[model samples]
Target: MTAIVVAGGGLAGAAAAAALARAGRDVTVLERDAAPAHKICGEFLSVEAQASLAAIGFDAAVLGGHRISRLRLVRDDAAVSVGLPFEGLGITRRRLDAALLDHAASCGAVVRRGVAIRGVDCSDGLRLDLAGEAPIRPDMLLLATGKHDLRGVRRQAAEPEALVGFKMYFQLNPAARQALAGHIDLILFDDGYAGLQMVEDGMANLSLLVDRARLQRVGGTWTALLADLVKRNTLLADRLIGSVPLLEQPLTIFRVPYGFVHRPTANDPDRIYRLGDQAGVIPSFTGDGMAIALHSATRAANAIIAGHTASAYHRALRRDISGQIRRAAALYRLARMPLAQRALFGVAGTFPSLLRLAAQYTRVPPRARSALY
Candidate 1:
């Protein structure tokens, strides 16, 4: 059997490599980073995401550092809290990535760290150019490089422009921690949305997602914009100000791009496949990015094991990922509209039951609604 080459050793790549190895295929994963690194994220997984993780036999205990049972939607002075039908897990990217990598290695995958992929040629089989080592040719090439564009792939012109993400860890006062325990708070303002949740080590993870223009309007620094947001949002100010202590230097990820690939490589139907963010990214607000990637990887591996062609894998990926992306995009677009945002949140706050119903809707699997009730 020909070896499968997976690029980017993040969650998606590692998961895909593991799945393929488990299916009795030789897999090699090339990662630029040597080990798990810190990343900026909400760190709160929805119930649906947890279910996906469980399906892959991942132990929830590894993510038990911080567990939340409530989801709070906040706007200015008013807030509505809804108890999640199921609990959500909170784990840092560092821990999650390390766990996935370890699992992939144990499953017989050859993980090559500190190796950067200079470029790829998919015309004749799959050729990968490494920075220091001689070029390698593999039977299949999987692109899982999250948010980073590779040179050969053709990106759609109509895709959404990348957004910026800012995050940091902090220690909160005992009173504040007590109030925030078992709850994930989402704060929405005119600029964008910010989320707060507790993670391992008795610290809270705070993240802000904002457009570049809005960041500029508030002064380039996220700290500056955050301060302004706090001043405008009294509830958030009261809960965090003077109580939360910064745990690490605030981190920022610029131009985190996302979109779909309309045209799969026509010339090379035998070798090329896209996975994870490289395939496309769902809006972060939906909290399903990692789950979608993992699910796609599994589906792709199954297709390969069944001896299906690359075109079949492409169609399957589109079918699985497009629906969720559309739903998330619609919700994100609605949130961007001032009037719609006000009305949606206003209605949600007025009728707590409605919020619960929405959560249920979000939690339902794509084709398993009959089983959900």
Candidate 2:
């Protein structure tokens, strides 16, 4: 049996593997994808996220992250621009994931790419049935599969009307890129929202989240949905008019449990650790998902190194971010309502600092940020 097995080599798994292997533990990561590719994300790296990655010896700036220092919120002809408390980065998940996995490999963790776990059985201990290779019975299994569930190892059900995500890269016309420079565009509609920003290579990422009913109403096609949105939302239409979509279809993920936070339950395996999206999922509107994924993995790794139980680690994670998650969820719900959005926009237009405050409160507490290492 391997000493430790990490499932899903995205942000969480790679970070955990690096931390564990750097500490001299035998760790192996099983990744489904043969290589790091585009992921459905807003691609906004908050200040806290940069700090966490730097603490672990990964520098996103060195990876050519685009600068983001402002927030532009729009609601159909009404828009508010505010300075961010700290400048963040706009980088694609593909670059970030590859760098972290390479770091893990350099730290002596074996990364097995093109490998997918068929199922997880923790009946006696932790056993993973792989697609091609023989099953692995590890001393500990760290679940970091980020929004996707493994067979036989179930996660808590998502909230009703769970959000589905779609992301497409576009080469924006010069005017549009210049207009979006240094700012993250957050365009809100009735049942969904979209985040637009410039990433590396002069490409713009347009990521969207809409509920199931909204998708069905559009005949379950992103193109049709986007066309309908353009007809209604002049703001979105203006930004996308001259942009050339780079993908045949947007990368998509369904039933995203936006407000999920995993707690230690009675049936959870004692030696199984849940990291990243397996641990919690903050609202995407908060722009802290990537940071939470990185920090939670590091935190869980520390817990395991200290001989702590999975339950203890989960409890600590809950303590750290549960309040923030709840606050984010409330704001997300409010932002979806037209009346609440008008009130929010009015208040934000009057007191722009509230926008920064909303960003602050929906993240890992400030008190805990400095101690992440």
Candidate 3:
């Protein structure tokens, strides 16, 4: 069998390569970054994500991830807290990705770092043009660039993307840590929400998803926008009272398409499989994007091993994940509306099980029952 080439060595790519190589298939992974580093992510691992990681043999607890058992939603002075339906973990992507890539390498997959895919030509086979290197043609290609698009295999253009995301890591004070331990907070404001959870290394990850126009109107700079948000969001302001940023600048990504789901096209000829954010973009507040990425990789690998067509795999994946994506999208829209946000909070406060129900609905279905599996 010819070597399978996976572009963008992220969670999806590395996981897919590891699974394929372990199955005795030759696999090669192309990564743009030379080393493991932080990416723009919420870093909350759902129960399904944990299961997938365990299936691949990397323990989140062993890697210093923090346990998260509760969900806290805060808006103005009103707040609602409920136990999560399942145990979750908070771990930095840097640590997780590094471990996964190492696992792939150990499984005999050729892990090529510092190589960016310039474009792909599939007229003959699958030709990958790498940065500063000769083209390589492989038997199959997996696109797992997360939020990025390669030169020739971009997603179909939809409506203009207007969501902007910002992320920062901070060392919280003792009191703040005590208050936030074992919990993930979703703090809502005018046009966005910030997800806060303590990851490994004893630092808090604060990820924000906001409307581009709203952020621009507030100030247009991270510091200014944050200050403006903090002024109106008392919960976030309290959490940051004595915290200090771990980095000099916050990570930011613009034009985030929060509800995108890619469908298979009729004209496609390449044996290309799209994974993770390349396949779909769930609302960040739902906190299952990583789960989707990891699970999708496993499913894709299974399909490839079973000699399934790329389109067939794509259709099955869409069928499996479309409900979660749609439900999350509806919640995302409702959460952004002020009155609806207050109403939902009231309902959750009165019947906390509703929140748990939503969580169950948004999760990636168990792998055993998954169609692709």
Candidate 4:
């Protein structure tokens, strides 16, 4: 049996491994982290994302531990709540990663936890250097490394520089929890936005997405930036003023670029495929990153199953996500413009239902609704 090696056993990697295993491919997944950890993610899965997972046979039990419901958008001091045309799920990355990894393993993929991939050499096949061991070569390579800059991968020069994001978990009061339950509150300001929600364990997830420039202006420390951000936004300040942080430290990452590869084929003779953030990123505003990754993984697996060439697979993946990417890019551009941002809030304040209408495209699935409610 031909074997495929997946680097980075996060959402994309685990999903890709599961898809491959389902297709009868022998798969190995390498993850740097051990079981059960949180990622600096929004933790709120949209309805569409949940639907995608359900289609892949993801277990509903994975989402059983949290609240589920529609999202509430807040702008200009006005809040608009809408039922996700579907439903959204909220689970900590700690729970989510473990569940995904377990699912991958159950599907017959070999998962190597605490194994970091040091390098990738794509020649006839792909050679992966593990931390202190001889390199292992596999028949095919899937780079789901996600957001970590690889030495040899070529990136588009025109792509916007990736922004930095920081998130920390917190235990909230019943009132605070109720305020956050079933709603992903997006607090928008100039240069960045913060998403607030309740996840598993009665904890609230506070995640911020900001440009590198703005982050630097705040001295590049989560403490400094978060303090300044709270001061600037009264809603956040009111909610978190005396709240204790659950994370020992805030999670941060930089330069997360989002775009499609004009060409997906590995031009470097590695025949290696990039998945998720490794492939390309979508803006977090849409909250579709994981969905895009899972969707792309399925597409890639199907292409390989049909014996399609790497280039052909790339084309198929591009075709699938390009439209959404284009729309996201346009929205990003608008968000960056001061007048547009103000105008957006103004309109949102006037027509609260608009936010709900916009969220329809981003709802989660029925099976995972408990987490978000």
* lDDT digits (tens) for residues 1-373 of candidate 4: 7778888888878887888898789999999897677786887665555655675678644666555566666544556566655556778777877888899999989999988878776554567778977889888877787777555554442555557888888877666777776677887778877889887778888888887888889897888898888777666776686688987998876666655443554464435677777665777777778777776676667666777766776676666666666667676778766689888877877876776655543322223333222
lDDT against the true structure, per candidate, is 0.75, 0.87, 0.87, 0.72
Tens digits of per-residue lDDT, candidate 2, 53-140, equal: 7876778899997899999998778889999888889999999899989999999999989999999987877789999889889999
Better of 1 and 4 by TM-score: 1
User: What 10-residue stretch in candidate 4 is worst by lDDT?
Assistant: 364-373
Q: How many steric clashes between backbone atoms does each model show? A: 0, 0, 0, 17
Model 1, residue 287: C-alpha shift (Å): 1.1
The digit string of per-residue lDDT tens for model 1 on 90-198 reads 7788888788888888888999989998888777767888899999998888888876667775444254554678888877777768878898888887757888888
Model 3 C-alpha lDDT versus the unseen true structure: 0.87
TM-score to native of every candidate shown: 0.91, 0.96, 0.97, 0.89
Worst 10 residues of 1 by lDDT: 364-373
Name the 10 consecutive residues with the lowest summed lDDT in model 2. 154-163
How many clashes (backbone atoms < 3 Å, residues ≥3 apart in a chain or on different chains) does model 1 have?
A: 0
Hey, what RMSD does candidate 1 come out at?
A: 2.8
TM-score of 3: 0.97
For candidate 2, give the lDDT of residue 315: 90
